[model samples]
Target: MDSISIDEILGITRGELLQGERDLKIKNVKIDSRKIQNGDLYIPIIGEKNNGHEYIEQAFLNGGSVSLTQEKDRPFPEKMTVILVESTLEAMKALASFNRHRYQLPVIAITGSSGKTTTKDLVASVLAQKYTTLKTEGNFNNEYGIPQTLFNLGPEHEMAVIEMGMDHLGDISKSIRSVDPDIGVITNIGLCHIERLKTQENIFLAKKEILQTLKNDGMALVNGDDGFLKKLKEEKNSYQVQTFGINDQQSIKALEYVSNSSGLQMLVEWEGKKENYSFGFPGVHNVYNCLVAIWLGHFYKMTQPEIQKGLDAFVPSGNRMNIFSIGKIKVINDAYNANPDAMKASLDVLETVGADYGRRIAVLGDMLEMGDFGPAAHYEIGEYARKKADVLIGVGDLGKEICRGYGQNRNDVYHVANADAAGACLRKIIASEDIVLIKASRGMGLEKVLDYIEGGNK
Candidate 1:
């Protein structure tokens, strides 16, 4: 991998070395001033809440050796290293591209509406079995995050799994321009971010933008089961592509699957061989995530045992599909974020795991960004919840629609205003050994309900 001096960064960013050492070798790169360390290059960002430039002194206080700033007229400590740029974010993009191209490793670009993060985790887990892999974590799939992820790469990494996410057009385009992915995977196209893009077709078109940056003759894989994503099927489309799904006949598939709160067991066929495997978590939705991992394993020529070990040892990140025993109560905490498709899948898992006790409880919150689709989407999930769970609790304004749908089937529907009130209402009605599912959009912060009920993570 190529190492950069202050000279190279200035050249790439078109920045002027306003003050400080020309020979300074950047040992690390950080965007947050509070995390900047001695010998680290700090890029202060202009965010919605605070200007990073205002924290230049703080960065210096935290031992930041070099800094990138756009403020030209500001006074600074004597002889300190400062690179002046037109835009800190644009400069970060330029520097990231420079840093990325220096390493000749293959970059797998993973993108889709809902399960991108989980898919990224599975891909990393499998690939790391055979290679020193670097992957994106947390919210590190965006513009600033991608650049920071790139900067974290060192000479030890043998491969890169870069996750790209977008809300509008050109978001993934910009990230891919820097990543130059050798392989591309689209998990599935769904109704997420539709309010901004308006329609599913528009979302499909926006997702296609990831294809523009594919390496020459690069492999593209998508969910063959999705009505929208199945459009990527080659005879039916343009790019040469493979498919992965449970039901798609011409794709890699999982047959005869069984899942519970503890884990999932499935018979998956790949490359003319069939094997049964078990993973640490339960969700039919995760079968899709594993399908992507299986094909990626084949692409890298990993042994079946290697792939199975990787899948078997993997645990989901954060709150997505995480089931825990809190005292005498069971809590399914899928509260990281929510959309209609994700909500429905989580419900399916809840129904499966909670079937024994049969006291299945669902505490649902509003699915945001639906625009005009809000009412109808909520109604669809609400109607399904009525049939699936024994008792239903609805939170958020749109949740009233869920209550209405539940009221159609049963009388035990309770509607609450927000997470706090929902937490209070749930404590009053929740019983021992009753399986509880708590999920909502990030804005609802429904995880707090677990704190109210079981005091969380017992």
Candidate 2:
């Protein structure tokens, strides 16, 4: 990041100079003290378990030039610069907003219940064909992550793809106001974060917050297949609205598509022109993701060939549909996170991959933070998996609901208490050449089963 003077920081954050020189500039900003480098600005965050105010000394020892703190009376090392703020997080957000506006590049903010990361990666990959694009790394789509992403922007970056995630009504508004994106993309509105938002309608309202701070002439792209987003297309709006999906009514539609173990092939119809495209991932949901990237590419005046090359060059981020083999068995590690929609999509991939390789085995764990909807969601996934998977191994408490939905009469359906039990059960029942799909929410730790299988187990 470009260096910013302590004076500029104080003005942007409305913070007070607590100690040391005001003329010093910060070349980098860090929240974690352990990651502090020479000439970096350290901002202490107050989390539930641990307070970052305690790490200031360590940050200085690690070569931090400056620090921001909420503690007004705290002692500091001699010759250290400290800025005092009411809230370090709010100060950081202000600093990030300031940094974002300093660059004149077009920022594309993406938000939705699912596929946000994948869509971000795809959009960045396509834009990288002609521009030095910077995207949100991994699942850094929350409040802290969004600001950290913005702080990484430099003069070399020509475009930015920021992924915003929300669990409440105003989460997107907070991030999007800082971003002020030129284009806003919503992948789909689903039951993700239903525990906090309560209903799909509430979730849609939360997701639509991406447009709250959007530029007046900005473009809004949405999934037409989603009922909520489709309704959005009919609403009166200040900005331009366009839809992309496989359905015929979308502004940019995928007329035909085929999914297989190798990848997906699609014949898209855009602007009365028909063209074929391919991606190196196997999922129908990914087709929807590709359409967004295609629209962005065309918006920036990229040719069809360039757009296709960008799509072809795309790669899935870690733990999201990451495919690999263990001896004769194939594993699809979608263990990063799962909801009903994502689980169903992965099961569909398992069906397609297993069709060409071997038996479809689904090792699914509990989807956490589902509140009262947890049982029915898990059970519904199980019922869906019954048709897609040849053998179903359900892990965790809610996983039993999946087994129940798949039917207890079936000998192939098994319910284990956790990932450990699922690992042991898989060791006993898994056959050679079988394709396994491991999926669960972030809290489920289902990656342990993949670890167990990869740790010298056939």
User: Which candidate leads in lDDT?
Assistant: 2
Candidate of highest TM-score: 2
Alpha carbon deviation, residue 451, candidate 2 (Å): 2.4
* RMSD of every prediction: 2.1, 1.3
Q: Where does the lowest 10-residue lDDT sum fall in candidate 1? A: 231-240
* Residue 456, model 1: Cα distance from true site in angstroms: 7.5
Score each candidate by Cα lDDT. Answer: 0.84, 0.90
Q: Which ten residues in a row have the lowest lDDT in candidate 2?
A: 449-458
* 1-458: candidate 2 lDDT, tens digit per residue: 89999999999989998889988989989999999999999999999898999999999999997999999899898789999998999999999998899999999999988898889999999999999999999878998899999999999999999999988998887777788899999999988999887899999999999988765698899999999998876888888889999875878899999999888999988888888889888889999999999989988988888898898888888888888899999999999888888999999999988887778889999988788899999889989998999999999999999999999789999999988888888888887898899999988888888766766544
Clashing pairs in 1: none
